[model samples]
Target: MLKGLGESLQVTLRKLRGLPVVDREALEEVLKELERALLSADVKVELVQQMLENVRQRAFKEDIPPGVSRRDYVIKIIYDELTNLLGRRYHPLTLVKRQLTKIMLVGIQGSGKTTTLAKLARYYQKRGYKVAAIAGDTFRPGAYDQLRQLLEPIGVEVYGDPNEKKSTKVVKKGLKYFEKKKIDLLLIDTAGRHKEEKGLLKEMQQIAKIAQPDEIILVIDGTIGQQAYAQADAFNRTTPVGSIIVTKLDGSSKGGGAVSAVAATGAKIRFYGDGETIEDLEEFDPVRFVANLLGLGDLQGILQRIAEATSTEQQEELMEAFKRGRITLQHFKMQLESVAEAGTLRRILSKLPGVGKGGPFSGLPVDEMDDESVKVFLAILRAMTREELENPKIIKGTRIHRIARGSGTHPDLVRALLKQFNQTQAMLKRMRKMRKQRGVPGMGGIPGMQGPPF
Candidate 1:
C-alpha cells in the first residue's frame, strides 16, 4: 500500500541529496517532487501545498545548530513537516483496569466499522483485558451473529439482542448484562450511516445517548480517499469523534488520502488495519509511519523487535555490525543462536530489509532449517579461525574441506554454510545500499551510524 508513493518520495529525496549546495532552486525542486508523490497518493491538494509551504518556510529560517550540516538541517525540516502532517504525537487508547471502559465505534456504512470492532476486541483480549462487545448495529441483518463468531472464539462474550429493533434498547440491555460480567473493555458497535441518512444517524445518536461511552471511535476505510474527511467531519459533528481507526490499508493505494483526511479533521488516528486478520491491527505512530513512507524502513520498530528477539550481549554485537553495515560469520552465529532460543526465524527474516521470502537471501533455507540444522551451523562456525570467521569469502573449496574435517562434518555441509554466509553478506550489502539511498537518517535503524539514510 502506497509503495509507489514511498518509491517516488525516496527518489525525490535522493535527488535533493545529490545537489552540492542547498539553495532556493534545489529546495523548490525537491518540494515539487514531494508534492507530486503526495498528490499521487490521493492526499488533498490544499493539505499537500500547505505542508510543503511549511517545510519550505521552516527549512530556510532555522539556523544550522553546531555540527549539523545544511543538507541535514533541510532534511530534518521536511521530515518534521511530514510527521506533523499525520500527527505530532502518538495517541493511545484509554484503557482502564478493573473497570468497564465503554468505547462506541461509529462510521459510514461499508467503512469496516464492524470488522474493526471485532479486531479491537481481539487486540484488547491479547493484552490481558477482559473484553466484551455489544452488537448495537441492529439494522444489519447478521450483525449479532458476526460479533458472536468473531469474539466468542477469543473468550470475549458478545451481548446483542438480534430480534431487538431499536439499537439503543439493545445497547442498554447489553450494558446492564455486562455490568455483572466485570468486563474491562466493553465495545459498542454502532450502526453505520451516510452523513445524510437521517434515520440511521438518529439511531446512532440514540445509541450514543444510552451507552454514554467513554470514547467514540470512528473507523474509516483506507480506500475512501479524501471523502473520509466528510465522513469524519459528520461523525465528529454528531458525537465528537474521540479517535479514528483506518482499515483496508493492505489493499488501498489511497491510504494516504484517508490518513491525511482524518488528520485534517483534527482526529487522532489511533490505529490502522493493514490486513483482514484480527491481528492485523497496529497502533499508529507518526514518526515510525513517516519513516516507513519515505523508505527509511521503520528503523525504530526494527530496533525494538531486535532488542526483544536477541540477547543483550548478542544484540549489542549485532547492532554494532548493523552500524558498520556488514555481517561476518560471527554475527551470523549470533543470529542462529537467537533464532534457536526465539524459534522465530521467519519472524525475524520477514522484517529484515531486503531479505524476506523472495529476497536476496531467499535461496537460504528459512522455514525448512530447524534446530538440528542450527547445531550443525554452530559446529562448523566453531571450527573456523578468527580470520576465516571475519572474512568467510576467502574460504574457497579447499577451506570448506578443511573446516569440514575440523568439525567432523561433511564437506557438503561446509559448502552449505559458506553459501548461506554469501547470501547473508549479499543481503547486508543490499541493506547498506538502501541505507545510503536515504536523503536523511534512520534507514538501517542504527542510532549512531554516519551518513544520511534513504
Candidate 2:
C-alpha cells in the first residue's frame, strides 16, 4: 500500500526539516529524492517528472505569501501539486435533474466491479438513498446469485435473470423495473472485458446505449502499477468513463499505479477499497489521503469511527471501570475486535507521531496473532458469566478448568490469556488516572490514532 514510499518520503522530509534554511540546492535535492521514491513505487515517469517540476516552479515563485518558512512553502506546494494529480474533489453522480441516477460500472476483467457495486449500494443505503443493483453481467457465471447474496444483507434489491443470455435486454428490463419502483440510484455491473476484445466492447457500448447511464465508473485494480493507465485509456476510447474506483489497495505493494492512473486519465477517483468487508469502501479525500501517503496520520477519521462505535454512556462506564482498576478480559476482547475491524495494526500504528522503524516495539511482528487465536480468546470470554467478566478475582482454579473445557481451549492457553488481560487492565488504569488528573472526563478514543477508514 505504498508503505515503503511513504516511509522514504518522511525520512527525506525529516532531513529537510533539520537543515538550517531551505534554499534552491536543498529543495532540488529533496525533489530528486521524492521523484526517486515515486518512480520506485511504479508511478508513471512522465507524471512524476511533471509533478516535481510543478513543485520547483511553485517553490521559487514570487507568488508565495510573505513570512512563510521556505520548508513550509515547499511542502505546501508539493501538497497542492499532489492533490491536483489526484482528483481535487469528489464528483457526485448527477442524474439528469428529475430522473433516477443510473451508474454503469466498467473495467477489464478481475478489476472487482461486482463487489464494488455491493459496497457502493450499501454506502448509498446508509445515506437513506434507496438503491438497487442490476446484475447486467450475464457473461460471468453466478453473477446474479452473487449479487443477490451480497446485496440481500444490506437490504438492497437485485434485479436480474439467472438464465438470461442477452445482456442488453436484462439491463434494460432491470432499469425500467427499478425506475418505475422509484429506486433513487441504480448501479449496473457489466461483464468485465479484455481491453482489446472487440466483441465485448461492442456489447458494452450497446448496453450503455440502451440504458443511457448517467455516470460510468471505471474500476481499476490498484496493484497493476502504471499499466492501469493504459487499461483506463483503452476503456475511455470505447465509452465515456466518468470516474474511477481503485480497488485492492489494502494489499497493493505499489499503489503509485493508482496515482498514475488518476494523473493520466484526469478522472476523479471516487472511492478506495481498503479491506474485504462491505463497509471497507471510503470516499477519496485528497488532503487526508496525501497526508497518509506521506506517513502522516488521519486523526479525524479515527475519532469519527470511535464515536460511532462507542456510545457516550458506554464511554463513561468504561472510563469509570478503568479508574477503578476493573478492566476485565471481556473488555480486552472487545477492544481487540474493534482494532481488527479498524484494519491492520501496523498500518494504523505507522501513522502515530512516534511509531515507526526505530520506534518502540517497531521490530515486533505486525499481526503475528491469527484470527483463529482471537476467536479462541473470544470463546473463552463467552464461557464466562457476567460475574466473571465484571470480577476476575472470583474465578478459582476449578472454575478456570471448567471455563477451558467449556471454551474448548487448553487450560494453559486460558491462563496465558488471563495474564495478558491483566497486564492490559493495569495499563488502562494508569492511563485513566492520568487522563482524569488532566480533567478529561471519559475513555474517549485516543486522539491522533489513525486506522483504516472502515
Candidate 3:
C-alpha cells in the first residue's frame, strides 16, 4: 500500500535536498508537489491542503527544535505535519470496565468483513481475551461456513444460522446466544450493504440497536481507493462507526483514500490487514505508518520479515551485522537472496519506506535489476584488496583494472559497479539526514551486536 506515493515523495524529497534548506520558494514548490501526489493517490483534498499548510507554517516558524539542524528542521516539520494529518495516536480496542466488549463490522460487498471477524477474534485471543464471533451476514453465500472454516481451528466459539433467510433474525439470535455464553468479546459480522440500499441499512440499524455494540467498525477494501472514505462517511452517518480496518493492503492498493476517509468520518484506524493470514493484521501506529508512507522504513516490520525469512544461524549472523552497522557485501548478498525467494526486488523495496516506491530511484525499473547482477557485483567487490574494501576511494583506475581482471569481468563493468556504489552511498547519506530529522535516534549503531562482519 502507498507504493506510488512513497516512490513519488522520495524522488521529490531528494530533489528538494539539493536546494537551500527550508527556503520559502523551494518549500512552496515541494508542498505543491506533495499536494498533487496525495490528491492523485485519492487522499481527501481538505486533509492534503491542511497538511501542506501545516508543513509550510512549521517550516517558516524560524525556531528550530533543540539539537536539530536547519535541513533537519524542515524534514521534521514535514514529518510532524504528516503524522498529525494521520491522527496523533493509535486507537486500539478499549474495553469498558464492567460490561462485555462488543464490536460490529460493517461495509459494502467484498470488503472482507467475515474474514476480518475471524481475524479480530484471533487478534483478541492473542491478547488473552475470550472472544466469540457472531456471523450476522446471513445473505452472503457461505458467509457462516467461510468464517467458521477460518475460525474453528483456533477454538473460537461461533454463533450463526447458516440456513437462515433473514439476516436480521440470524444476527439477533446469534447475539443472544453469545451473550448467554458470557463471551468477553463478541464480534458481529453484519451483511455487506450498499449505502443506497435503505432497506439493508435499516436492517443493519435494527441489528445494531439489538446488539448494542461497544464499537462499530467499518471494513474497507484498500483497493477501492478514494471510494473507501465515501463508504466510511455513509456508514458513519447510518450508525456510529468507531473505527476502520482496511483489508487487502498487500495488493496494489495505494491506501491514501483510507487516510482521507479517516478525515471524513473522524474514525480511527484500529488495525490494517496486510495479507490473508490471520496473523497479518496489525495494530495501527500513526507515527510508524507516516514514516513508512514517507519512505522512512518500518523498522519493526522489517525485522519481523527478516526473522520469518532467515534460519537460526543465518539470522544470528544477520542480527550481529545489523547491531554493528557494518555488514559485508557477502551478508548483503545473502539478504538479497533470501528476500528474492518471497518477492520481486520492486515488491520488496516498495514495502520498505526508505528504500522503495517514493525514494531516490522511484521511477527506475527495479524489476529489471536482477539477482544475477547483484551476485556479479558481490563477486567484483570480493576481488578488491583489503585496503580497497576498507577505503573505497583508494581504488583508482589501476586498482579497478586489477579488480576487474581478478573477477573476470570487463573494466567498464567494474567502473559501472563503483559508480553504482557511489550512488548508493549518496542515497544512504540522504537517509541519515532524513532519519535524524525524524528523531530516530542512534542510526550510527545498534545495541546487541558488536564490530563489523569480516
- Candidate 3 lDDT tens digits, 193-247: 6645365466667778888878888788887776666666666666655578888
> For model 2, how does the per-residue alpha-carbon lDDT over 1-454 read when each residue is reduced to its tens digit?
4557677777777777678888999999999998888887788888888899988887887344334466665665675577666654445443332348889888777788888999999888787788888999988899899889899987899999978898899998997788678788899989875555465466567888988887788888888878777656655665655677888888776676565676577666778887777888877766557667765543334332332333222333444554454666555555444333332233334343221112111122222445456557777888888888768878879889999999988888779778766665555566667877888766444321243111
Q: How do these models rank on TM-score, best leading?
A: 1, 2, 3
The CA lDDT at 128 in model 1 is: 88
User: What is the alpha-carbon lDDT for the whole of candidate 2?
Assistant: 0.69
What is the lDDT for 441 in model 2? 68
With a 3 Å backbone cut-off (N, CA, C), the pairs that clash in candidate 2 are none
Find the number of clashing residue pairs for candidate 1: 2
TM-score per candidate: 0.63, 0.61, 0.61
Question: Model 3 residue 49 lDDT?
Answer: 85
Best by lDDT: 1
Q: TM-score winner among the candidates?
A: 1
Error of 1 at 174 (Å): 1.1
Off by over 4 Å in 1: 195-200, 297-454
Per-model lDDT: 0.74, 0.69, 0.67
